[model samples]
Target: MDIQLLTRKIPIGISQCALGEPVRYNGGHKHSKVCTQLLGRCFDYVPLCPEVAIGLGVPRQPIRLVKSSPAADAEVRVIGVEDKNLDVTEPLMEYADSVVPALEQVRGYIFMQNSPSCGLRGVRRYLPNDHGIDSEGVGIFAQRLREHFPHLPMEEVGRLNNSEIRENFLTRVFAYDAWFRYVEDGQDAPRAGRVIEFYSAYKYLLLAHHQQKTRELGQLVSNARALEPREFAHQVRGGIMEILAHPASRKDRTNALMHVQGHLKDYLDKEETAELTRLIEEYRLGLKPVSAVLTLLRHYLPRSPHQFIHSQLLLAAEPAEMGFCDFH
Candidate 1:
């Protein structure tokens, strides 16, 4: 596939603070160069600040999650730090609900870490007595959005700093966007045929993430006619996103790469085959990066005329845009 397809700006949601906006409680920005400079190249950001959206002005009082009782699952509220009486948990959730329609266009969302309103997870939670837990809370607004858009790809700016995590997140984002464009948004009604084709394209990509789940999904797609079209589509979509959610392990990736190599075995000479196998083993042993194997595969790709081999997303340059070239 032409890598240029991914160059078309993908619309994604982001915390305004990540974009260098002064939307935080202290009227400061937690500007992330990664969000604004790197990922921004392909993503057209739909910036949002739940705190500011909920009528909390810039330089507003800071809020923290406070547990009503010291229980395993206590009712946590976003309470004003200094003014104990002010609680905006419900308002934050309500604001998240209100933005659902607008956010529907976003394939993924990047949240600000450690935020009371926008943190994806691991925000600080405090006991009513004011003692704080190290990290045991999810921001109210982020929680609400997760509940509403369960399958939408979400990540924290802090987490995206890691190359592997960033690549995995982008892979999910592109796959999510690909599903809607190719299968769900087809001119005709979505059918088993389109779903199968879509799955075929992502087969090795999924296998690299989770082998058992990928095989199970293969069976699900095989029996697509047994379920209603909409239901089948939903199941397939959920499965694909879930599989891609796990970062592709080096061992599993080597396995997927070997599968790709199998397709080209008949097309390569003895020396070429041995060279490819050596590189794959080196990658499996961490002696080399996955890119080395991929580079060798691309050299052999043109010699193989199998369309299916060519169709694999794993072989395409498009994934390189997601930092797959640097994936270790």
Candidate 2:
């Protein structure tokens, strides 16, 4: 329930072009004001350009991943479309491999869409034998990043324009940022006490994901009085994966609402309770979760206000309740 954290800065990775650099194929940028304005207020951007890092100069020879053969599997060639000169695939691959490991500090990555080098998903991967391609592919660099940091919250700039997507990504980034410092810092063994302390702060967020697994994780932490670093890391990792198996959905919101409703039971009247229940029910059936919760809170809080019971306080609701969201 650290409301101050939402006001804290989040470290986010972004494509160089997205940061207003002229790194695109046509030497232009798709500068996003929303990213630079609203979200930027809370994010410290780390800009990267894989192609440029691999020694491609500004306005350099354009390269595209072309199919060498259909049967060659993923034998895509990064060749210059004009002169048919150099194949830069090997260098790009090597560069991506190097860069991914160096970016362990990043909790989230925001990539450009449809880029041959930086797209998070759905970049075309040409096959081996014939001039065929598969759209169900990710950029080589992005793939390497994901493989190295499997739990990092990754998104695209285009998608981040949506309020829900933006909020979700930001949430994950901050959560991961906190985990890195509190749980995985290597300062000491993540004892049951420390793990519980962190979990207590993130209970409600975890409930939206996997409540049962969250409890199991807490139990493991309690059971391990003298656990080694490796054992602690492994258990924590499993708990994180389970929490991130799915993002927040309407069902998750309804589950979360049930918890909050229980907390508000003594505060609201019968008529108010019915409206709140109906709102949560609607959210369970696919309406906006935030809207439903906000509507209820607005109508009731002024009459019987408890600052500690605000949605802001939900961030610290406990694992079973907080299971509603995940970062890494």
Worst 10 residues of 1 by lDDT: 319-328
Model 2 alpha-carbon miss at residue 93, Å: 3.4
lDDT per residue as tens, model 1, 1-328: 3222654688999999999999889989989988888888778999999889889798999999998887887789999999999999899989999999999888999999888888988999998789986587888999999999888999999999998898889889988888877787746668778888889888998999999999999999999879998889888999999999988888888889999999999999999999999999999999997877887898889998887888788765235635422322
Q: What TM-score should be assigned to candidate 2?
A: 0.75
TM-score per model over all chains: 0.93, 0.75
Error of 2 at 259 (Å): 2.6
Model 1: lDDT of residue 315: 65
Give the true-structure RMSD of model 2.
Answer: 5.7
Minimal lDDT window, size 10, model 2: 319-328
